[model samples]
Target chain A: MIEVEGLTKFYGAFPAIQELSFNARPGEIVGFLGPNGAGKTTTMRILAGYMPPTSGTARVAGFDVVDQSLEVRRRVGYLPETVPLYPEMSVFEYLTFMGSLRRVPELEDRVDEVLEQVAMLERSESYIGNLSKGLRQRVGLAQALLHKPEVLILDEPTIGLDPAQIIEVRRIIQELGRERTVLLSTHILPEAQQICGRVLIINRGKIVAEDSPGNLQAQLAGAERLVVAAGASCEQLLQLLGGLPGISSVRAGSRDGEVEVATVPGKDLRPLLARTIVEAGVDLMELRTSGLSLEEIFLQLTREENDEQAGG
Target chain B: MRNVWIIASREFRQYFISPIAYALATMLYLILGGIFFINVYFGLETGQITPDGRIVIGAMVTILLFATPAITMRLLADEYRMGTMELLLTAPVRDWELVVGKWLGAFGFMSVVLAVTWVYPLILHRMTSPGIDQGTLVAAYVGLLLMVAAMLAIGVFISALFRSPVAAFFVSLGVMLALWIVGSLASSSGTMGQLAGYLSFVDHYYNNFYLGVLDLGDAVYFLSLTALALFLGAQVVEARRWR
Candidate 1:
C-alpha cells in the first residue's frame, strides 16, 4: 500500500535520508527502527505528503506523493512526532474539523468511532489543552484515524507515554495494523520487536539492516543471556547455574549481586532456572532474559559495514 | 473550493475561540456610537436636517486601518507558532485553499464587526427628517467590506513571513500606516507624488466611496490589491512544501 524509491532528501547540503527504497503491503506492520536524526522523520514526512523529497519518489495507496499528493494525503493517515493540535478545541471538535478537512463521510460518526478506537470516548468533550500528554497523544491518533485511511505513517507512536499507556497504544497499533498498512518508527529495539512484523534498522541516513526481529536478533546476537540477581554470593549462584542443562556459559562479573547466564536460542529457561534456584535454597531476587540493546546491534553492523568497504 | 470553505470555517470558529473578535467588535461599537451621537446632536441643535456619513467614514478609515491588522495578524502566524500549519499543509487541501480560506475567514469576521456598527446609521436616519441616503449607505458598507478584504489579504501575506503573531501585527500595522500617509507625504515630490497617490488606500477611500460615488476604478483597485496579496500568500504557502 506504500512504496518509496531512491528517496533522497537534502536540507541544503546535508542529506537527511539517502537512496532509500522500501514498500509496505496491505496488513503489514513495518517498523522503521532508528535513533534520533536517523532520517526517520524525514522519510515519514515525505510519505505523509507534508514535504516533497529532494530527489526521489514516494507513493501511498498507489498515488504518487509528489504529483498526486492530495490523493496520497487522502488515503494516508499521518501521526507526526509532536502531535500537532489546536489547544482550544475539544477532542470531539478537533476530530470533527480534521474529518471535514479529510472529506470523510459521516464525519461525526467516523470521529466517534475513531475516538472509541483510541479509547477516548468519554474525554471527547474535554478540551485538548486540558488533557494530559497521554490523552493528547490518543487524540492525535484519533485524528489520524478519522478518515479510515488505507495507510498509516506514525512517527514514534509511543515515545512519551507511561508503560501502561504505551502498552495500550501498542495494542491499538497492532490491531490497526491487522487491517491497514502500518509504518511506525521507534528508537526502542524492544518496541519494534513487540509490534513490528519486520523492521528496517536505519542508521546515518541509510538502512543498515532489514529483516524480521527474530532473524535480525539471530544474525546479530545468536545467544541470549538471562540476568539472574540473587541474595546469595555470585560464586555460589554461578556454581549452581553452571551445572544447568542447555546452559552454554555462565559468568558473574558485570555486577556483584548478579550472575549472567547464557543459553541457547528458542528456549524458555526462566521456569527451569527459577525452580532450580528455589530448590537449591538460593534466594532468587530477579530472573529475566536480556535482549541485545540497539547500541550493540549498531556497533556490530557498522563494523561489518566498515570491513565490507575496506574489502571493496 | 470545498476544502477552502472547510479551512475557512475552521479559521472563523478560531476567532471566537479567543476573546479577540468580541473585543474588537465592542470597541468598534463604542467608538462609532460616540461619533454618531456627537454628529447627530450637533445637527439637531443647528437644525441641519440632512444626514451626513462623511465623519463616520473618516473615523472608520483610521479605525479599520489599525483594527484590520489585529484581526488578520494570526491568519497564518499563529498556525505556524502552534504547529497547526503542519496539519493543514499535510492534509488533502491545496495551498491556495489554505491561504484564500484564511483571508475569507477574517473577512467574514470583519463583516460582523462592520454589521455591529449599523445601528449608528439607523439612529442617524431616525434623527434626520429625510434620513441618510440609502445609496450612500450601501456604497459605504460595500466600500468598507472591500477595503477590509484588501487589507486582510495584505496582512495575511505579511503574516506568512513570521511565526510570531505579535511580530506580524506590528509589521502589518507599519505597512498600513505607510500606505495611509504616503499620499500627503509625497504630494509635492513630482512623479513620486502621483505614484504615491495611486498606492494610497486612504486617498482611494476618501475620494471615491467617502464622497458617495460608486466608482468602478476604485472598486477595481481594492480587488486588484486583494488578488495580488492572495496570490503572493498562496505562493508562500506552496513554498513550505519544498525541502
Candidate 2:
C-alpha cells in the first residue's frame, strides 16, 4: 500500500534522513524502531504528504506524495508525534471537524464509530485539553481513524501511557493491524515485538535491520551461552576450563556466593563440566543455559553498530 | 470547493465557541461606540461634525484600525501555535481552499463585531431628525465591509509568518498604521502623492463608498488586494510543504 524509494530529507546543511526506502504491504503492521531524532517523524511526515522529501519519491495507495498529494493524503491518516489537536474543541467536535476536512461520507456516524473504537465515546463531549495524557492519545488515535484511510502512520503511538493504558492502546493497534496497513514508530522494543508483524530497526537515518521478531531471535541462537557455577577461585577456574574438552573458551566470574564460569558457544558443557568438577574436587552448584531475550538482542545489535563506528 | 466550505464552516463555528471572539467584538464595539458618541456630543456642542459624511467616514476608519487585528491576527497564527496546522495541511484540501476558507472565516467573524457599530448611526439618526442619508449610510457600511475584507487579507497573510498570535497582531497593527499614515500624506504631495494615495486602501474607500458613490475602480482595487493576499497565503503554505 505504501512504497518509499530513495527518500532523503535535508534540513539546511544537515541530512535528517538519507536514502530511506521501505515498502509496507496491505494490512501489515510494520514497527519503525529508532532512537529520538532518528528520522522516524521525518519519514512519516513525507508519507502523509505534510512535507515533501528533499529527493526521490514516496507513493501511497499508488499516488505520489508530491504530484498526487491530495489522493495520497486522502488514503493515509497520520498521527504526528505531538498529536496535533484543538484544545478548545470537545472530543467529538474535534473529530467532527477533522471528518469534515477529510470529507468523510457519513461524518457524524464515522465520528461515533471512531470514538467507540478508541474507547472515548463516553468522554466524547469533553474538551481535549481537559483529558489526561492517555485519553488524549486515544483521541489522537480516533482522529487518525476518522476517514478509514488505507494506511495509518503513527509516530510513537504509545510513549507515555500508564501500563494499563499502554495495554489498551496496544490492543487497539493490534485490532487495527487486522484491517489496514499500520506503520508505527516507537523506541520501546517490547511495543514493536508485541504489536508489529515485522520490525524495522533504524539508527542514524538508516534501516540497520529489518525482520520478524522470531527471525531476529533465531539469528542469536548460536551466541547463547551456558553459565556454570563451580567452587573455585576466579583465576583458577578460568585456567581449568580454558583447555577443557568440548569447551570453546571460558571467562571466570562470580554470581551470588560462588564463582561462576561463562562457557563460550559450543556443545552442551553442563555434563562435561560436572564430570570435570568431580575429578577436580570442586563443588557444582548450578548449571543453566542463558537464553537471549529480545532486549539483549537489541542491545547486542546496537552495541555492534557502536563498535563498527569506533573501528571506522 | 466542498473542502473549502467544510474548513470555512468549522473555523467560523470555532470563533463563536471560544471566548476570544466575543471579547474582541465587545471591546471593538465599546471603542467604536465611545468614539462615535463622544464625537456626536462634541459635534452638537462645537458644531465640528455637523452630521456630515466626513466625520462618519473618519470615525469608521478609526474603528477599522483597532478592530481588524482582533479577527485577523488569530486566523493563521493560532493554528500554528496550537500545532493544528499540520492536521489541516495534511488533509485532502487544496492550498487555495485552505487560504480562502480561513480568510472568509475571519472575515465573517469580524463582520459580526462590525455589525454592532450600527447602533451608533441609529442613535445619531434619532437625535437629528432626517439626519443621515440612507444611501450614504448604506454605502458607508459597504465601504467598511470592503475595507475590512482587504485589511483582513493582509493580516491573514502576515499571521501565516509567525506562530504567536501576539506577533501577528502587532505586525498587522504596524502594517495598518503605515498604510493609514502614508495615504493621509498623499493628497498634499503632487503626482508621487497621488500614486501613494492609490496604494492606500482608505483613500479609495473613503472617496467612493463614504461619499455615496460606488466606483467600480475602487471596488476592484479592494477585491484585487484581497485576491492577491489570499493567493500569496496559499503559495506560502504550499512552499512550507517542501521545507
Candidate 3:
C-alpha cells in the first residue's frame, strides 16, 4: 500500500535520507529499525505528505505524495514522533476536531469508534494536558485512526512510555497490522523483533538491511557457535572436535566438562560431532546451538555500514 | 471551505476557553469605557455636548494596536511550540485554509470587542439631545472594524514567523507601531512625504473615518493590506514544509 522509490531528502546541503527505497504491502507491519538521527523520522515525514522529498517519489494508496498530497494525506494516518496534540482540548473534542479536518464521513461516530479502539472512551471528557503520557499517546493513536486510513505511518510509537504501556501499544500495533499496512519506525530493536513481520535496518541515511527478524538473525548467524557437555577432558575434546570437518576451532569453555566449538559459515556440524562422540565412546550430556540475537544482528549491520562509510 | 471552517471554529473556541481572551476583553473595555466616561464628564463640565463618538473610535484604534497582538500571537506560535503544527499541516487541509481560518478566528474576537464598544455609542444616543449623527457613527465603526481586521492580519503574519508567542507579540506590536507612526515622521509636503503618509495606517484612519468622512480609498487600503498580510502568512506556513 506504500511505495517509496529513490526517495532522497536534503535539508540545505545535508542529506537526511538518501536514495532510500522500500515498500510495505497491505496487512503487513514493516518496522523501520534505525538508531537516533538515522533518518527514520525524515522518511516517515516524506511519506505522510508533511513535506515533499528533495527528489524521487513516494506513493501511498497509488497517489504520489508530492503531486497529490491531500489525497495521500487522506489515505495515510501519521503519528509523528512527538504525538502532537492540543493540551487544552478534551479527548473527544480533539478526535472530533481531527476527524473533521480529515473530512471523515460521520465524524462523531468515527471519533467514538477510534476512542473505543484505543480504550480511551472513559477518559473522553478529560483534558489532554491532565492525562498521563501513556493515555495521551493512546489519544494520539485514536486521532490517527479516526479516519480509518489505508496506511498507518507511526514514528517511534512506543517511545517515552513505561514498560507496560509499551507492551500495550505493541499489542495494539500488532492488532492494527492485521487490518492495514503499518510502517512503524523505532530505535528499539526488540520492538521490531517482537512485532514487525519484516524489518528494515537503516543507518546514516541509507537502508543497510531489510528482512524478517528471524531471517535477519539467521543471515547474520555466520560462524555459528556451539556448546557441548562431554565425558572427556577439555583439551582432548577440543582436539577431537577441531579435527572434524566444518569445525573451524574448539576451545575449553568456562565451566568444567564443557567445550565450545566454532564452525565455518553455513556449516551444520552437530550430527557429525554427535556421531563422532558416540563412536569414540565419549558420553554426550548436552549440545546446543547459540545463534545471534536480533540486537546483535542490528548492531552488526549498522556498525558494518558505518565502518564501510568510514573506510570509503 | 469546510476544512477552513473546522479550523476556524476550533481556534475560535480556543480563545474563549482560555483566560487570555477574557483578560484581553476586560482590558479593552476598561480602556474604551474609561476614555468614553472621561470625555462625557469633561463635556458636561464645559456645558457642551460632543455626541460624536469619534474620540472613542480613535482610542479604540490605538487600543486594538496593542490588543490584537495578544489575541493573534498564539495563532501559529503555540502550534509550533506545542508541536501541534505537525498534526495540523499533515491533515488533508490546505495551507491557506489553516491561515485564513486562524485569521478569521482572531478577527472574530476583535469583532466581539467592536460589538461591546457599541454600547458607548448607544449610551451617548440616550443621554444627548439631537443624539449622534447616524451616518458618522456607522462610518466610524466601519473604519474601526477595517483597522482591527488589518492589525489582526499583521499580527497573524508575525505570529507565523516565530515559535515563541512572546516574540510574536512584541514583534507584532513593534510593526504596528512603526506603521502607525510613519505618517508623523513624514514632512507632509514632498513626494516622498506623500508616499510615507499614504503608507501610514494613522493617516488613513484620521483623514478618512475619524473625521466622520467615509472614504472608499481608506476602505480599499485596509482591505488590501489585510489580504496581503493573510496571503503572506499562508506562504510562511507553506514554506515550513520545505524547511
Best by lDDT: 3
Cα lDDT tens digits for candidate 1, B1-243:
988888788888888877887788778777887887777677778888457644476787788888899998988998888888878888888988899999998888888777767777777777766777878877877887888889999999989878999999999999889888997855677788888988988778877786778899889999999999999999987886684
Give stretches of model 1 more than 4 Å off.
A222-295, A298-312, B45-50
Which candidate's TM-score is highest? Answer: 3
Give residue A143's lDDT in candidate 3 (0 to 100): 85
Per-residue alpha-carbon lDDT of candidate 3 for residues B55-165, written as tens digits (9 for 90 to 100): 578777777888889999999999989988988888999998999999998888778768888888888888888888888888878888898899999999989999999
Which has the higher lDDT value, candidate number 1 or candidate number 2? 1
Candidate 2 A-chain TM-score: 0.86
lDDT of 1 by residue, A1-312 (tens): 888899999999999999999989999999998778889999999999889999878888999999999999899888999899888999988998888888889988888888889889999999999999999899999888888889999989898899999999999999999999999999887898889998998876889998888778777777888999988888988888899898999999577869888899778899999999999987888998887765578667766766885899
The segments of candidate 2 whose C-alpha lies over 4 angstroms from its true place after superposition are A220-222, A230-247, A254-286, A291-293, A296-312, B39-57, B188-191
Overall lDDT per candidate, in order of appearance:
0.86, 0.82, 0.89
- In terms of TM-score, which candidate is stronger, 2 or 3? 3
Compared with the true structure, what per-residue lDDT tens digits does model 2 show for residues B78-158? 888887888888888888898889888888877776677677777777677557677887887887888889899988888
* Candidate 1 backbone overlaps, count: 0
The residue pairs in collision within model 2 are none
Docking class of predicted structure 2: medium
DockQ category of candidate 3: high
Q: Would you give me the overall lDDT of model 2?
A: 0.82
